[model samples]
Target: MGIVSTYLRAFNTNKLDPYPVEILKRVDKPTTVVLESEIPRLDERESGFNRAHRGDFGPHLTRERQRFVGKHPLSAALGNMQFTLAHVVDGIVAQEKAPLPNDPALMARHIKETAYFLRADIVAVSELPSYAVYSHSMATGEPVELNHKYAISIIVDQDWKTAEATVGNDWISNSMSFVAYSTSGFIACILADYIRRLGYPARAHHARNYQVVIPPILLKAGIGEMCRIGDIVLNPFLGPRFKAAVVTTDLPLAVDKPIDFGLQDFCSKCGKCARYCPTGSISFGEKVTRNGYEKWPNDMEKCTRGRVGNTKGSGCGVCVAVCSWNKPYTPFHRLVQWSMRNIPVARRFAVWGDDLLGYGQPKLKNKWWLDLEEVDGKLIVPTQAGQRGNHRRKQA
Candidate 1:
């Protein structure tokens, strides 16, 4: 068997580890009990990506789109799959306005089931908040407004084997990322197309190809809670290891409430991501209020510059690699997760134990793919691909 196959089998049949992991509490409505925020409506242009391109962050970050993951050959090919299928002038407007038995509940079930069938890790529905829509398009500099009332969030996990095998910001970094990006993008497009066939307006929002911001919509959908990694939402199950794509539509369906898994407190104490960040882009300081949102005040410019100009790799995910929450979905890890969630004292021990067990460091034997860098229409070996890797640490 391949390295990934072997790892999957091991992860699946963790019979030796007798710890139990349970499902998180699901609610009838969205609630933000822990995240205290005067979270104001943010313009689409205000995002770090747009800011970087528009020179708000700096001149260097302007190269983000042209260079970072998307611009690389492997990532570009994956993106092409998304771009080729992103828009459908005819398919989006179903040939016959066929209506299913106007049962929003059934529609919701069928939609979620369809996404699951398409390989989505998890699915949830929520009311897409107005503030979540971007004010303008980053690519065309044009106004983009989707009046879709509901958002169906589809999440896809970046395979654990890859994340475990390679240092987060190596040559294979973007490949690991694009696999999830393109897969989720394909699923979103299909779901949107399905919704359109139902005679309702639906649009697929994928990586950088979106008419709306995803974080708030995700929060509203009860998919995840915001973590210390600068407004990035982390799922109880997937943690920060997965990427999300949204299917925005006017489908009348049951909506989910925001979830509070006591992450705000956990993040306050465990800043492993911040400590492991190579560029010091992630903040170790306490969360601060910014633009009506109560979160960390990270240097978007620094983050963008680090990503765009990484001499060692196409992009970085070291933060995700080092995150204590990004573990396998096994009984043992699940118990650890529950402990971290329910027991405050366990949080500190979990962070320390994660390092002692060498969770963040790469398992070089599991490395399967070649470390080839796609540059200027040529694939070349990166000079210092995994040299700086991850640092060994005892505590946060």
Candidate 2:
């Protein structure tokens, strides 16, 4: 057998060494519990939370409102609906496992069509490298192994409406996280079921519970290239304002080629995300060797610690919000990104122009959600004393 075939057989037999579980187990469990409990309360107090702890771009809630429509009931309902449909699709795919489908290309196309119909902004397939699956899951400290050889990476767009609403308060920002996670989870679950129905072994990798690193798989799938912000950068679309989920399987499919869009060159000069990172976790230097790869290395520990220490919410995405690449689907910006892809010299100018236009500045006036009177008929405004207390404890 060829080397690739041999490795595949070995992987299927579960002979590969699993990732160490101890690293994951080391996190303080009590702290996690406390964070989980605070998420909802934090969502309610988003404006107060931001007012208390101002960062480089000002109150995070204010910035969010400028970008998104805030926590609208319709958007939240749509997210939940998409999630439910994903589960239904999963069931259908699982039950239809074939006497083996005849054509791999046709099958892949159908899968992509189904995924797009289910609310995925983009879908692509690629061979899953053995290294893509982690040695262990950090959340549960569980030893994990993946025998699957293919992965389907799905990207979902964050609502521009909700992102615009973020500037009003913390509730809007937290709600976006809620929508993305819930929607991505549903997509992964359904895709996993679909692969299994084709008589192939499959598994869904969702947020905080993934076996595979998403960005690499996304790159392999021809969906997008890795940008300076260390996330998969989509083109002529949602840019960096998207979340990813993966479904690994043994299904046969064609792979995609990596695209060159001058992102590396642009990132070398543009430190927008690094500057906007509230925890200073993003890198601002040249790419360096880490685990045998040349890339920007982030301070993952510091990032997580910052999230844990946040008195208002579960996590942060200030880097994402402020990135020049995080553009809405506007004709003017689309033309700019398209031009930058073809003309290498225009990249630096593009980056500079984005900054000059105040692209990264937070907007305070768009705070529509701050006027919210109540939810479920009970008033939810933050008490003045509580707001003051949180502000006093803000980190410099």
Clashes of each: 5, 22
Residue by residue across 269-332, what tens digits does model 2's lDDT show?
7777776666666777667654434566677545544443433332356666667777775546
Q: Would you list the C-alpha lDDT of every candidate in the order shown?
A: 0.74, 0.55
TM-score of each: 0.86, 0.67
Q: What residue runs in model 1 are displaced by over 4 Å at the alpha carbon?
A: 1-22, 26-41, 54-65, 70-72, 89-92, 95-99, 386-396
The number of the candidate with the highest TM-score is: 1
Looking at model 1, residue 380 earns an lDDT score of 72
lDDT of 1 by residue, 278-305 (tens): 7777887777767556676677767777
Error of 1 at 28 (Å): 8.3
